[model samples]
Target: MPLEKIKVIAFDADDTLWVNETFFRKAEEEFCALLEEYLPKEEANKLLFDVEMQNLPLYGYGIKPFTLSLIEAAIKISNGNMTIDLVQRLIEKGKAMLQEPIELIDGIDETLRRLSEKYRLVMATKGDLLDQERKLINSGLENYFHHIEIVSDKTEKQYKKLVKHLDITENEFLMVGNSLKSDILPVLNIGAHAFHIPFHTTWAHEMIDDKIDHPNFRSFAKASELLQIL
Candidate 1:
C-alpha cells in the first residue's frame, strides 16, 4: 500500500476537481423556498432529500434527476396542487445549474498537471455522463487526464473493474477524492490506496459517520498538500 507502488491515480470529479455540491446546495435552498407555502423550509428540504433517495435507483445522479426530484417533491409537498408554472421554474433551475460556470478547486489544476507527469491520471467519478464530460471540458483540465471513467455510482466492484481496465493490480491504483462514501471506502475495500481531500460541504447521501482507519487510507485538507507526499 505504499505510494511508491501506485502507477495509476484516479481522481473523483465534482467537488474534488471543481465546485459542485455548492450549486446543489443553493438549488436545494431555492427549492425549499419555492415550496414554503406548502411546507416548512426544514420539512421541505427533508422531503426533497427523501424523494431523491427514492428516485436514485431509477434516475441515478445528475442535474436532470435532481430537477425531477424537485418537481416531484413539490407535488407531494403541495398534495398535487402545485402549479404548472412552478414545475416550469424547477426545470429552469436545473437548466441554469447545468450552465453554471465551472469553478476549479483551488490548486487542482497545478496539482493535476504535476501529477500527470509521473502518474497515469484518470478522472473517475459517478454521475450523468454527459454532464460530467461537459464539466471536464469546461474546467479546462481535461488534457491532464489520461482516462475518464464515469460510472453510475462508485463502488468496490467499479473500482476493481477500473483497475483491471487500466491493466494494473489493485495495489498499483490510488484514488484521490472528497467523499469518504463514494471515493475512499470503496477504493480501500478493493485493496487500493485511497486519499481523502474533503470539500467544505457534502451531500447528505454521500456523508458517513465512520472514522476510517486503514493502511491504505489518508486524509488531507487541500489539493496542493497532495504534492508533499505523492
Candidate 2:
C-alpha cells in the first residue's frame, strides 16, 4: 500500500495536468447568458446539464459534444425558435474552448520531472482523441510520459487493459488525478493505488459525494506533495 511498490505512475489529463474544466465553466456561463432571453440564467444552466447528461452516450465527452448539447438545450428552451445566428455563436464558443491555452497546473512540471526520474510515467486521459492529442502537444509535456493513452472512458475494464498493456501487475500501478469517478475509483477498484489531487473546479458530471476510505487511496492538496510521498 505504500509508494515502495509503485512502478508506473499514471496521470489524468484535463484538470489534472493542465487547465480544462475552468474553460468549460466559462463557456457554460457564456451559454447561459446567451440564452437568458429564452429562459432564466439558472434554468438555462440546468437544462444544459440535463442535455449533456442525456447526450453523454451518443456524443461522449468533449467540446464537440458539449457544443451540440448547448445547441439542443437552446432549441428546446426556445421552443424551436432559437435563431441560426445564436447557434453559430454557440459553435464559436466550442471552437474557443478547443483553442484555449493549455496552462499547466502549478508545480506540475517539477513534479513530473522528478517522478519520471524515479517511476515510469504514463498519461491516461479521456476526450476526443484529436483534441486530447492537440492539448498534449501544446502542453509540451508529451516527452515526460513513456506511454500515452487517450481513452474514450475510464473504468475498471479500461484500467485493467492499461495494466495489461504496460506489462505490469495491478499492485505496481498508481493513478493520480482530479476526478474521483474517472481517475481514482476505477484504478483503486482494479487493485491499484490512487491519489486524489483535486482541482478547484470540476465538471458536474464528474462529481461524487462518497469518501474513499481504501488503504491504497490517498489525497493531496497539490502535485508538489507527491514528491514527499514518492
Expressed as tens digits, the lDDT of each residue in 136-208 for candidate 1 is 9999999999999999999889999999999999999999999999999988888999999999999999999
Model 1 score (lDDT): 0.95
Using all chains and alpha carbons, the TM-scores for the candidates as numbered come to: 0.99, 0.98
Per-model C-alpha RMSD: 0.7, 0.7
Q: What would the per-residue lDDT of candidate 2 be over residues 95-141, giving only the tens digit for each residue?
A: 88899989999999999999999999999999899999999999999
Candidate 2 lDDT at 122 equals 97
C-alpha lDDT score of every prediction, in listed order: 0.95, 0.93
Lowest summed lDDT across 10 adjacent residues in model 2 is found at: 1-10
Give the lDDT of residue 163 in candidate 1: 94
